[model samples]
Target: MLASASASKAACNQETLNTTSFNYVNDIENQTVHDIAVKFNRGVCDIGRANLMVDVSVVPNVGQTIIIPGQVCHPDWTTCVIDGPGTNDCLIGGPRLYYTLNGDTMWKIAGRLNMTLDAVTCGGDSCNTNITCIDGICPGGGGSQYTANETIPAGQFIKIPITCDIEPYTFSAGVYKDLAEKYGSTVGQIQMLSPTYNYSYIANEGGTFPPIALAKNCRLLSSNYTILS
Candidate 1:
């Protein structure tokens, strides 16, 4: 419920974009933050240009008290992953769920949000969403089955697997050792999904990895960190 900005700056704040999106409570002239970023598909991240009372003529009158930023789509939009610039895999929007607090893991919570590690350990079929069954002998009710290096505790909700319009490739500097010898995969297996950029800092900032069959859905963590970097 609180730990959103710790894990080494949340593995690089991957588009929870300083997190928040309540999804309701309109007042900006009866709801005008692009109608709360289209009801809640979110993208407004927020930036009043400079605020000379601009945008929708500077809303906040009808009721006054605008803040909304606590919701981001994921009741299961058919368990997204519309790769290849199609439009579905959160990228920087949301496949949102996020709950865990105390030093949350899962590859720094899917490397903040740039997602990888088999899409947060849910992999191809995309996991999470058990619901805990207990009486039924706990199946979906108990949820949080997790695997890949497991740990994730806090409140444990996590289910972010987004993928809209594909965008995650960074292999600069002599081109990631020649794309790891043409996708045979090495260079520490492409830095196990690039936990925080490497390969000479993504070729001195030019960046462009994710190629070998979508970087082979990485997520190779073992030396976790939530801060104290």
Candidate 2:
């Protein structure tokens, strides 16, 4: 009787260990699906029936599709279809839309959105403030306007005004120094206004320096800066 009890206890421990390992594996697989969705710029549901399989592992490549068999949940395991890919009718969530001004400091975008730059970028290394034009176009009617401090909704297309000139010459560092020397403004203050250049090669070529507009309220000390074409 003592040997039998010990054998039963060992079996129970093994079962528990197996259960824990299965749960861990399932969690890891779920996370892998989520990460792949984000990386591919596709929706999670797009994985379709292939994502619903149980006791099965799948490795998908870019542009490849797979099918999964549906498994039973806790309440109904018998009725589940385990033979084939379940369904392709998964619905996609809407695209997340946000806005940024070219060459504006990250702090300014965060302040405008009433969110930290870290929050906006999902804590990524890329700077939120230095976003380029191709990120998205200014929405119709000048995009969604917000007060200097407003919390923007996720997936809402924000339209920030392209107030700064795409001056041929001004880069962020140059603008910072120029504003400091001429207007007695600090680099932080100058960066609040978004300054950008229209031509990419000009900025790369180190040609003529252009003056970008200060924010709407900034007073120009000289008439040299032209409105970007």
* Candidate 2 pairs with clashing backbones: 50-68, 97-155, 169-210
Residue 214 alpha-carbon offset, candidate 1, angstroms: 29
Evaluated against the true structure, the overall lDDT of model 1 is: 0.33
Give the whole-model CA lDDT for all candidates, comma-separated: 0.33, 0.28
- The digit string of per-residue lDDT tens for model 1 on 47-128 reads 1111111122122335433444343322111111111111112222222345543334555444434445554454343322
Model 1: per-residue Cα lDDT at residue 140: 15
- What root-mean-square deviation over C-alphas does model 1 reach? 18.3
**Which portions of model 2 show Cα errors greater than 4 Å?**
1-99, 102-201, 204-206, 215-229
What's the lDDT for residue 177 in model 1? 31
Per-residue lDDT for 167 in model 2? Answer: 25
Error of 1 at 221 (Å): 8.1
* Residue 219, model 2: Cα distance from true site in angstroms: 10
Give the top-scoring candidate (TM-score): 2
Each candidate's TM vs. the true structure?
A: 0.19, 0.20
Question: What is candidate 1's TM-score against the reference?
Answer: 0.19
